[model samples]
Target: MQGPLLLPGLCFLLSLFGAVTQKTKTSCAKCPANASCVNNTHCTCDHGYTSGSGQKLFTFPLETCNDTTSSKTTQGRKELQKIVDKFESFLTNQTLRSTEERQEISSTVTTILRDVESKVLETALKAPEQKVLKIQNGSLAIETRVITDNCSEERKTFNLNVQMNSMDIGCNDIIQGDTQGPSAIAFISYSSLGNIINATFFEEMDKKDQVYLNSQVVSAAIGPKRNVSLSKSVTLTFQHVKKEDPVLTIITYVGLSVSLLCLLLAALTFLLCKAIQNTSTSLHLHLSLCLFLAHLLFLVGIDRTEPKMLCSIIAGALHYLYLAAFTWMLLEGLHLFLTARNLTVVNYSSINRLMKWIMFPVGYGVPAVTVAISAASRPHLYGTADRCWLHLDQGFIWSFLGPVCAIFSVNLVLFILVFWILKRKLSSLNSEVSTIQNTRMLAFKATAQLFILGCTWCLGLLQVGPAAQVMAYLFAIINSLQGFFIFLVYCLLSQQVQKQYRKWFREIVKSKSESETYTLSSKMGPDSKPSEGDVFPGQVKIKY
Candidate 1:
């Protein structure tokens, strides 16, 4: 009886142990392909694979393992690789290469590069959270940077590298477009592209030794537009080619410096000569101040590219200062219109009071508001890599140009109205010779002022067509010498200012003569002062 009972118990124990081993095997058997069980407990996707559920280790039987690199970034790489392969095949295949002309080959390569850039930027934008994506193969390489933080102070620009080529671009260029949210830039480099579309494709490469394809053919672009032009110039640091002309820069500096000095003198004249310190002179004074500050800041800090935030601040300041100048020009127009309207009135108090009330707010507040709106909307567009000025991207320059054009138009209309009013006033008051002469003088000064303050800026807009080069030079010279024009028109031309200048000059000469006489008397010693001619006025001669 004992032997039979022991045998049954042993068989039962064996059956129970076998059931436990079967359960452990079943647990691991449920894991999908590209995944394995860990310690017979949980499932983990293999290297280069990810679980559909996004977990490293998962026990759910429904979870599937997928290729981790097959996401958007991989898709981008594959697209770029496909383009490279197709181009390579086209280049290598004798049948294809033999039929294509040199121009055709160049065109085909250009199309490929543009396509690669567009595809890479599009892919990077699709996954902006990635921030950066780099893909490399034997024939091609690409690197992308996504700027989604609204270009904070710490990240105002970006530098990207592919192969041995690199690009430096401002964040604003990438972020400025119709689309909102994140922006991305892609740099694609082709290892074999330079060989086919090398220096030969460049029409400017006339000299063999002077120019050659020193680096791999690289393409850069920003999404979603992928425009060939950028608001800021992208600095492409090729391995062996580089260049800049400083002649224009030097001209600009010297011209602006002279204008700045003239502006200072004109401002001093306007402030000190109480005779010319009326509403019109005040307008000239403010305009001179604005131009003075703008030119001074530009001379000092326009090229200061480091500490990007400071550059941006300088740019904002320039924008405001220039806008303020134009605003004052508008005020001048209004004042001229009011003065012309009230030319026959005895008490010009109302016009003066009206001007005093509105000039300050309109001159300064309007620009401040304009800058604030622009900055709040797109602050990144304020500064660029090369200069601290308004950017040309997305019609951003219009912030300055728009106000300028409007002011110019209004000034022009006011000018016409002023002349109209002056014409009637002069016609009716023909017998009053003094009034007619004063009105004619006023008309002449208005014409000159209008030309200096409003019309010269039109040259900037005319910087296109056949006359672009000429217009550019004219714009530079006339606009840079704006301070000189102001001083010339307002101070040197005004009879009152001339009289004051002459009086000041005479006083200076007299003071110098008196100073010399005192020096001579001192040198001659106390006992040697015998000449009565040496006694200057306002000095009491002591009698012993």
Candidate 2:
């Protein structure tokens, strides 16, 4: 009886398990191809596929799975190809060709180039998984490269070719800062654009030789900012271009080198010569230091276009240093004005204290803030294609030029005010010959300083019209040798500084003579040792 009962119970359990397994298989049988049923209750698309309704899990039998990876690539290619088609249409349009004014044609060409570059870069960034995309339409061609991984040590730059035009860009330009995601660059070439914007647009071109566009009009840009300028100059390889004069390059290098040396000497004099250590000398020292660094960087790295991030950093540093130099110059003018105003005061301890309080903040902090704001707003304008300097596009150069002009104007006003004050002081002190002479000397120095530090910069703005060539040369020559002017005025011309220099020279000569005499006596033998009177003991030595 027990065996019979146990057999019946086991059969009933086996039958129940079989019925459940059959139900589960029937439910999963409804799942479509390229999809799998989960837990016998819901369906999920297989790898490399997505559900039509975008649901990860679904019970609907009508849902279908689609290949998404292939579709995305197709969509990205179509989008880029569409850009090429649109650009080709724009260039071939009859309305664009009918335009007469060269300026209008040039402006339209620029707008078209920018638009094409921006759209290509945008599309590439949106579909960064498509690492490389190239499309060629009727008269236009575009190629894009997307970087999503760390650049190898061996490959610091990437090159993109479109038609006969090509661009070489630094890897860091695309990666930008430390962003660990994708960065994309687009290179575009227009076969017909050069016809519209030819050599005629360049006013500097010689009219004697018949010049025309010899290369395709090409544009290159990086996303997401898509600035007109690049951090490193994109080395554009085209069919035709001219070379710059080597003579001018040599002159520039030599001039800047000499100026750097002079600035160094001026800074040292301002620091070491206690006689000239005042608020004015402090201003001079800072000015010299700023110019020294600016010139040194300009001479060495101005044309360093590789490693885009480094070039941009160099450009920003140059911007800050030059602005700092001008700011210090403004401070110099302010100090000169204050000194002139308080000529009657025997001591300027109060003035010195005031300057000390405000000078560092205004002189250095102002430029730093200015550069920060400029960089934050339009970082792409920090470097250019030809040089590691502010780009002259979209009025971006005004970031540097605007401040310089304002400072120059303020310095000019201060100079005039100081001159007026000195005149009044001189007229009132006419009875005292010593006072008149001092006032006259101050006036002369003020006049010289104004020209040396402020007015010469005006030559840069005068580089237009028939005299432009003359003004360019003059500007380069005078401005490049600014350090020489500073050294001459602050160290060589100042009576107090001149005296200190003479004293230093005498001390150096005296030390050399004593050393020679001691060596001679030592060479004569032990019997010829110098006596106690001949040896100067415990004399205070200056540590320069």
Candidate 3:
């Protein structure tokens, strides 16, 4: 009985394998161009295409892919209707045989497909330059020359140019639980496979709600929360957007390079120069170190977004490091204010002790705790597919922005108070000439101090509306070269640092001259020793 059962099971397994193999072959054999078989039976469309019923682009008869603009409450219908008329006129003028189909895939979306025969079918002509439109999730997407159907064996296939207008993308489904508006993002199919990749922020129209993208951009998604699911169908719009600006790229890389060099030099100077060793220099050193690490990590690992977990870790690190740098800047401002307050005193020993007690714990510990809290709450939102930084969705970016704003506020207050104190002190001096000179010096230092302490980040907050470009450039140039300013003000211009450099330079030259003379005397000959005539009167030579 056992042997009989075993034989039957083996036969059943063999039959099942054969059936699976046959199904796989059938799916692949019938799969359409630009489509592939998955799981041995299902044929999936390539990245830029979608099925008629809003399913994954599948190889089904009568299935048509549609591109569309944004879906909504009939605001932009007039413009879209004009485009539709143009499409119909094109079809009529060409005498192209076509069929129209309307699909109600969901309660919110209606997909319309106007299938026009290829020109190659009518005459011995190349395929007409056509455009394709798809509507899903309340956006309009247009694609030109979507299909190339010609007579050659490699190219002979049905091609389509589709257009969609005024499709409804239910806004209720897109917003989900979030109160903020959704962002318009585009999705494209992977070149080598059937998966989708989001290519967001390609371009925006002059109108508030509409976006424009290219044919290469296939689907449009709402918001950074791409993972969110929606109950209704979406229509994506595609239009051409300019590539990344070369000028912006040039500014960023060049500024970062100069900042890195200056930071490294400043750090070295602080470490090696004992004369400048104090609470101020120590604070500057730590500030430079934090900024250096933050910048270096960003430049190297920002684009390493492949492994999701690693990208999240990088985002967390960046969050902590940048916060720490800003915290140190805050500490620097506090230290300066303290110094200014106590300038009338003979010594700063008390202030030094007080700073030592306060600076380190606040500078390093606060950012760590904040980051830890943020990570604990929503670690998954730490990074996006394209950026290894905090997600803008669900107010996660506030974790960074909040601390920066607080620090900036505190620093600004400290700056104002310091200025007031300086003004009062200058007024107290009896000599007019001395007071004028001191006032001038104080004014320059105050301006430089505000910039050095990361106050230029204010420009970032003010970047809005028409002047956004001007503010953006100013923000980038000022903040990116902060390390250079620190080096210039704290290291190069400091009297103590300059004196130390000059002292070291003279000693180095004197030592080099003595070594050269010694070398010349030795190279005269092995037996040649310094004589009384060659050497100073007190010099003596010993030979062994």
Candidate 4:
């Protein structure tokens, strides 16, 4: 039994080895064309042509197209021309085929045939079409050609002209999820080979639903053979919406002047108005300033760079700033909770100090770290055109998603505890549970401030779809507008800042056109501030 089994196994192994060696020789190995030395066999198929895999250009067993004396060379040439024409259409990547590519392949086939004493066929033509050597009566005659070595021998090693518009692309292929249309899909090809690249999964779009918005995804790489290819893609959960009900365009600037002016003044308030500045409000001011500046820079930077990393950097930073502001707002919540619980509000001097430090890591550190890790793990992920992104890695959920879920949970607990503490202490005040009661009113006020301060900023980090573009504008408005709101609240809503504002407002209101009043502390001299007449249209001046 062992002898019988061993015999078949050895034979099978030998045949497989012979097939592999022949295939390898065919791949790049050179041997006599149409001639084999195996057991004195003179006409074995080309080293690799018939021994193993697919068809070979010069399979050894058939080097000469015709060896009969009855056949005419002209007819054989036409037959060979047909095969060359059919296959030449298949070469797809070279822009200009040099004589070198054509020559190398010719030499490989000729070397094998000359060894068999048979006529060889070889010729190199121009980039578009090629010609073959005339073979008749077992003799060879060739045409003189200049360019060679530019065509691929492999079946897929051909050139294809691809012309596509980035705007006409759709996301139907990527978002393929549980029985729905593709979350997103992209098809891209390059004019170069040996370079591997593909589009990333991002953006939420559906053409079956008649939605039209180009997905924004970008990736580029140089493959092993120095072939250059680039791909970008994005995918998201499917949602249906009216196509005409929305449009985002540069023309959306119709009413943008007012928003821009307000944002500018809001920005200047923190930068120039010392009386309105503080650590607590400064964070909001910086956030607002960054957002406005980022948008402004983006508008200027687009179409300016070879690759456009600045727009992406500004965009990503804007998102990071939004979250940072929210981190600060979280700090605000913790602070307000302490204030509401104590009959006397807690002093925030030290806590604010600690918070100032904490916000950097919570707001800046986490996003930065996550981005860095993702880029290092796979640098192809950096500065993608896809909307605010997280890594595809599962742990990325823990970085951003974990924080979001944790923050929401913490907010819930803190919110409940705030009410619980208030209710327990409510009995001591011996008052009915009036919605507008003193403590309740104060809590409501705090809640309102929290909403005014951190609410919009928190909308990011929600891990939603490609809404970052829209959410980015919202982040800018809420973020930049917060500076003005904070100034109005702490500086104008309070009696101290308000009395000061009111006194100054009245003085200016009642002043002579020639004489102006200022708000840089009444104790200071008139020389301490700008003249009241200095007021200009659309410009806000708060001296104090």
Candidate 5:
């Protein structure tokens, strides 16, 4: 019985092995070009290829995988245009001024744009079934996900993907749809689309070299129900929406914190120190106050997008405050130039009087009028979905940038005049203030004043092509710490203020010693003997 059972089992195993071998042999058969056999009997096109436009033949020999680049160029553009046209319809029919609606529009438009862009990238790069995108620590899978609108109960689904090599670094940094490339670049040309779409050309530290060869811009005029065409000018790039650099965030917050501390100290010093109270310190005080309020409001309320009126009010306040700060800065420069012209005059007494009369009205009034004009004209352009600042549409940003640039230009001229006058006239004035005569001190003060008077913002003007990132970091760092610079130059570095601080410190120490001595003496009874080194009645000789 055991032998019979073993024979049957061996027969069954042999039959199973024969079936497996047959399947393997069938799958190993030669397949059509750009196609492969799978599951022993079926043929499928290779990755990046699709089957020919015909019915499958019995022998599976007629089907072929064809390249999709030309077909994709024709069909993909049609689909993409439809998406853009949909957005254009929405823009035409609906008002998107509210912060929430604007954000929804931005996020939706970019999502559509990036999806089509990714398909274009796959065609360009000839990538396979996997997404061409190469995120640092994410999967290669692609699937649609829901985008739930926060402002309303609306929800839509979309996929975010890109096609690029993992080895290609900084090819996707996506700087404002700006790129220089041997590779074609794709971007959403309209500024209203927001920063959701981006592309990067240079890798880190490679920006300074090969600065000129950027790709062309393709303008798509997607009108309501309009047919759109794709041009060869534009290509697509990818950017992952990730949190900002932790290091930069830390640096910004830390710098702002230091600036706030310094501003407070400077304000207190200006208020209390009678010795340093002067026209310069007064200008510094107002500048410090404006900056303090601006930065504080920015840190706290810049992203408070809800309650739209509140956000607009905050934007208006920020605009006014920052403009006022720059206005005071202009006053500082004018006063400095006047001081240089009146070098022989002791204490800048007459200049000080002249400034006091005009500073308040000019410093506060100009910003008020500018804001009032802006409010009266385009009141709705105050806040954006992302930031509580002037809108960039319809040349509205110029309301701020225009005044700033003018002030910067005037300040530049003032700074140059002051420097020239100081160099030419310093040696001739014997009775000039000691602070203004020391060449090193004077040079340092002049440079510091230049920065404080908003010359550093000129760095923004140089933010083009290759030097954009460098100039951006410099501008952010220097301007963010403007309050600290004012305090350093006007309060901590001033000889008069330093002297006052030292005097105050000495007095504090002296009083502390006296208090300790009195406590010690009081602990002893009236009949108790004084220490051996005691001076006249209850006086202990204190050494400071």
Candidate 6:
């Protein structure tokens, strides 16, 4: 799996097999008794390539496949017949005459589509798997699979697979799914005719499928031979392969559902649950809210093409929102340090929600706005599906690099102050010094997470080399699981938040118990306090 040898090797083998292994035009060795090579290339059947009459291509295509003056081999004709029958059955099946039938057909088609696409995925999963495949024909894909396919289960899908040497196929482009699993399925069926191979995931029983054959270019390919690699466009139907694991999508579900619900809960907690609204808890709650809302909108509405155009808009916006909220959380940590620095009285006049909100906009928002404007003006500069990231235009160096510089600068300043202050305090006091050390360490961890996130953005610039891919996945997985880290640092691991949460839980339980004790299910009396079940304020119990 040395880097230099992989792609070139694949290209050579593919080109070799495709260019040389090609059969010489002659009387097909597999052609029937009546079959004749009138054109010196194609082995014409008594009928044609169509069903019921045309002899198959067992040796119908290449001249080398011909056996002049001899009858077609039985095996060759039967194999050809099999291919014809599969296509013919689609044209004639009467079971698919209704809307319900089409849905059923789509399901069956997916099963078959998954088989082929999975081959590509499975092959890719192996050690030193092919990351990209370039087809000289219609740039088709082979290793794609279905992900998040919980529409229904217990249904089996029917699949068909083919391997061809050459075909009359031309493709514009091909792409992988945005996520690990396949997002769509297509049944693009086509014949090689004279010099190419065409493939479809499903054949439309009728016009209802409205299966339009569209394509794009990608740097990858899947084939009959594992070793042969070619940059030919092999017509492909971007098949949707189903994903089977529930555990993998737990976070997706959390972000899309539970995390979103947490946004509302956090907001309500702030408004009604008074204890959750202090400086530290409030900041954490607010950060959680922004993340929840942004993802909710992103997951639900970012799929349509015209609206999909909002991918950049959404990506840019979410980037800011995500970063801004995270920044705010960082800022909150800074504020705590400032208070410890004896600067607590600097802004005790009144709580400035507006100022805090401004931090989020400035933190994630400014960068988002900057990147969006940069990408819109020079979109090609934006990374496509391969890099699978937000791309910036000419000034991206500024938009991206600028933020990193600022964030890192701020972190440096904080750490310096912390170092100086902690050093001075450690000499006189051990208990206080230990507390400062742990607090500083938590801030360091948060800062490191941000640094990593920033690095993810920077890595987009070098999407060409092998290291870039490793870093890309690192960025993707880390960013994807950031919430867990935040939870660990702010809630689970932070004893401060743990104490607050325990106190809040007890209050909720106590309030619920009080309600039941008094039989006060309905708030008929004005003096009645809203039950903890109705409100979600995080209060520092200060139990002592």
Judging by lDDT against the true structure, name the best candidate. 1
In order of appearance, the predictions have TM-scores of 0.58, 0.57, 0.55, 0.41, 0.56, 0.40
lDDT of 2 at 16: 94
Clashing pairs in 2: none
Off by over 4 Å in 2: 1-243, 429-431, 526-544
Best-to-worst order by TM-score is 1, 2, 5, 3, 4, 6
Candidate 3 local distance difference test against the native: 0.62
**Model 4 segments beyond 4 Å from truth?**
1-279, 282-306, 343-353, 356-367, 384-409, 422-427, 430-442, 449-496, 507-544
Model 5 CA deviation exceeding 4 Å by range: 1-243, 347-349, 427-443, 528-544
lDDT per residue as tens, model 6, 1-544: 6888898998999988776445544334545554555545555544312312334433434222233212222333344344444534543454543334545655654454444343443333331212322211112322222223322333323232322211222121121212233232222222211111112333533567644333231222322222233234354333221122355345445535644554555455455545445665666666776676666655664443232345545555555565566466456546544544542234643344544655555655665676667666665333322222343222444554565556656755665676566556545554554566655664565455455334444554454566855555554455554455555555455455467678889999999888664554343255656544453233222221
Which has the higher TM-score value, candidate number 1 or candidate number 4? Answer: 1
List the lowest-lDDT window of 10 residues for candidate 6: 190-199
Compose the digit string of candidate 1's lDDT tens values, residues 1-544: 8999999999999999888767655778689999988988788998657898899987777799997544866776677678778877865676655578777877877787777777787778767767889876546777889887777764366888765478988887777755577788888777656645553365456566555466667777777765555777778876532122266566678889999999999999989999878888888889999999999999999889666699899999999999999999999889888888888787888998999999999999999999999999988777754568876545789999999999999999999999999889877934377778779878987898798888789998997778977777787778888888888888888898899989999999999899977876776688875465455454555444
Top TM-score model? 1
Model 4: per-residue Cα lDDT over 1-544, one tens digit each: 8999999999999999999767655543343444344433233453213433232333354243322222334444455455433323322223422233545534533443232221112111111122222221101112211113222232211111111112221111111112221111111221111111111111234546643434211211111111222123322222211122233333223223333455565656556555656665565565555445544543444334224355345444544554454455555566556645654434656656766777666656765675566445644322323333332222433444455455555655666677777667665765445422647655664666655654654765542567856665565555445445654554445444455557667877787432432333343465665565555433456453
lDDT tens per residue, model 2, 197-273: 66337545778875656667777777776445457776989844323446656767877888999999999999999
In model 3, which range of ten residues has the least summed lDDT?
190-199
lDDT of candidate model 1 versus the reference = 0.80
